[model samples]
Target: MIGMSLLVRLALLLPPNVPQIPVLCYHQIRDWRPKDRTADKAYIMPPATFRLHMKMLADSGYHAILPDELYAHLTKGTPLPSKPVMLTFDDTDGDQYSIARPEMAKYGFKGVYFIVFNNINKNKYYMSRAQIRQLSDEGHVIACHTLTHPNIRKLKGSDWAAELDVPARKLELLTGKPVRYFAYPFGIWDQQILPELSRYGYLAAFQLDEPRDSAKPLLTVRRVIDDGRWDTSTLDRYLKHGFGHK
Candidate 1:
């Protein structure tokens, strides 16, 4: 441990460069799920594995910045030091409120949680209002996941306005803090429809695409992750070296 500390201490003396933020995207926290059968996909990570990943980041000398902070750095062209990262969760599942939040708190990092407002009480699979508030009070961003998880590209005019704004307003009513960010339902916010995002007062939006190597596009920022099928070595490689794998 002393040698590892000495190594990090030495590395910190290096020069500044672009912050390669591997914004890790996650959902549904339960017992471990094996990598899916169809392809090399990055999706649902179990709560325990998520803990290991956070510990790994901390040990490797990475800082877990929030989505808004990352946006500010990228937009302002401010480079993060070596191994900068932002951890994020979407859908605002109840399990995230129950399991993931505590584990992440243990690691001293808070994630940006995008939620579907309509399911706060109507559905068992999603988070309830009280649970959502507790998470916000704990310091995580409970941003919007739209009212009903629609494709923003397909909708226009009032539909677009409603999809984007109402949930944010709902979150505001619930938590008393203004909602400042958003995430597309399936990483499907196309370029032609970006103006509506501004109409609803969003400062930044995220997409669960590949790792962002260069500067990010305004509407869609990129991220990478260590999901199922990615063992510890693969996870380390993806975070420290490669772009991303499916």
Candidate 2:
């Protein structure tokens, strides 16, 4: 473990010219309802729109890569597929399993599911433990979101264990694999927490649209949220803008 940590520290010092890979963060994958707030609709993707996004990606030859491939590419200077993109779901919504999974499967794509551990089997709208485990078994990466989706910037002391360590252990048990990646709740993080994340054995952590920490780029890996309102053309533009290619 010490040697691995030393390797990571050495890798962290490398120039950040690693190929630009677009990582899309998604939330609920269901259609909007009458009760849905206007602001909340940004995160609630309708089924048809979601399908179109997948179709576009597939048609455009975008290969969905998982966390391990991404880590290797960034740290060890490994080569990626012709058009590598990462589809990451946050918050463990039930629709991600019921809807997003099959849609991605059609394109022979896999995704990273960042789970809120406390919500499993407890919240009606969230995914159950069985569903999460199945995703992991099916080769999709199961990563940590947090215990309760709290803003990580406010956490202190044992709060870190509750949010990071405990949940990560629970997820590993459920998935029968190590949880080595994390997505910050509400895409918020602090520099002080980067070392804490490393101490907890995370290889990397993701945040939404934030400039990466120059010295610790792995911990602050950036992602862009796939808004519910986007059309196929909008997705194409954003992909090009974010990754410098279509």
Candidate 3:
């Protein structure tokens, strides 16, 4: 595992001749609380900062693509836009409907949201089922996160089945379109589940960091977490620096 991890890190160092599409992973697009000052603030991407990101992308000619488009590019050798990017929001937070959608629309962009089916419409923090459907109706891709957002690696048998299959079934019923992609809960994954993912008819799956398998693309694809610290200039530097850990 250590050797594989090292190989993946080294592989990411080489510059890609093709356009290296960045799948930006975000959680909350809302204000940070004073109590969360000492806590992990990466999940809370401030609305103004998010606006700056959208503005920067728009100004720089970056266009967001759906997750399925990303899958097609990776698997079928399909061509993508000159400056392809994918904006993926995990956990289907209510602020996504309330804040991020409007902010993205300002740049005429659509993002993919991975929803937790069990939490939908059940709490103030989560987007309701109707709101998720509305996003789908408006062209945002609605994908499955899981039923209860449990770490799949820790689950087995029926527990694993419920985690992987149930939400996907419900999502398909909600969207009317096939649920083509998935994002791992907490960015946790096991390659053993890849076969099951294929069985579920998922084109690809995403994780928070670079994937271990570059030989076979898009099973557990890489994504960069858009924490609150990013601004336009810093982001340019980060991408220019091979998106490697600084």
TM-score of each: 0.80, 0.94, 0.87
Q: So what's the TM-score on candidate 2?
A: 0.94
lDDT of 3 by residue, 50-120 (tens): 88988988888888898767655654568888677889999989998899999899888999999999889
lDDT of 2: 0.87
Positional deviation of residue 238's Cα in model 2 after best superposition, in angstroms: 1.2
In model 2, where is the ten-residue run with the lowest total lDDT? 1-10
Candidate 1: Cα lDDT at 6: 38
Better of 2 and 3 by TM-score: 2
Query: What's the C-alpha lDDT at position 214 in model 1?
Result: 28
True-structure lDDT of candidate 1: 0.69
Ranked by TM-score from best down, the candidates are 2, 3, 1
Off by over 4 Å in 1: 1-20, 32-41, 77-82, 210-216, 243-246
Give a tens-digit lDDT track for model 2, residues 1-246: 122478777765655555468999999888799999989988889999999999999999999998889889887778889888999999889999999999999989999999998888776888998999899999999999999999887899988888988999999888889898999999998977887887788888899887777777788788988989889999999888776311
- Residue-wise C-alpha lDDT for candidate 1, range 1-246, written one tens digit per residue: 012233223322322233346777787766643654434345666566777777777787877777667655655555665667777878768787787777777778778888888878777877888988888898888888899998776786689767887788889999988887788887765655555665565666777664321222434566554575466677888776654322
Best by TM-score: 2
CA RMSD, predictions in order: 9.6, 2.1, 6.2
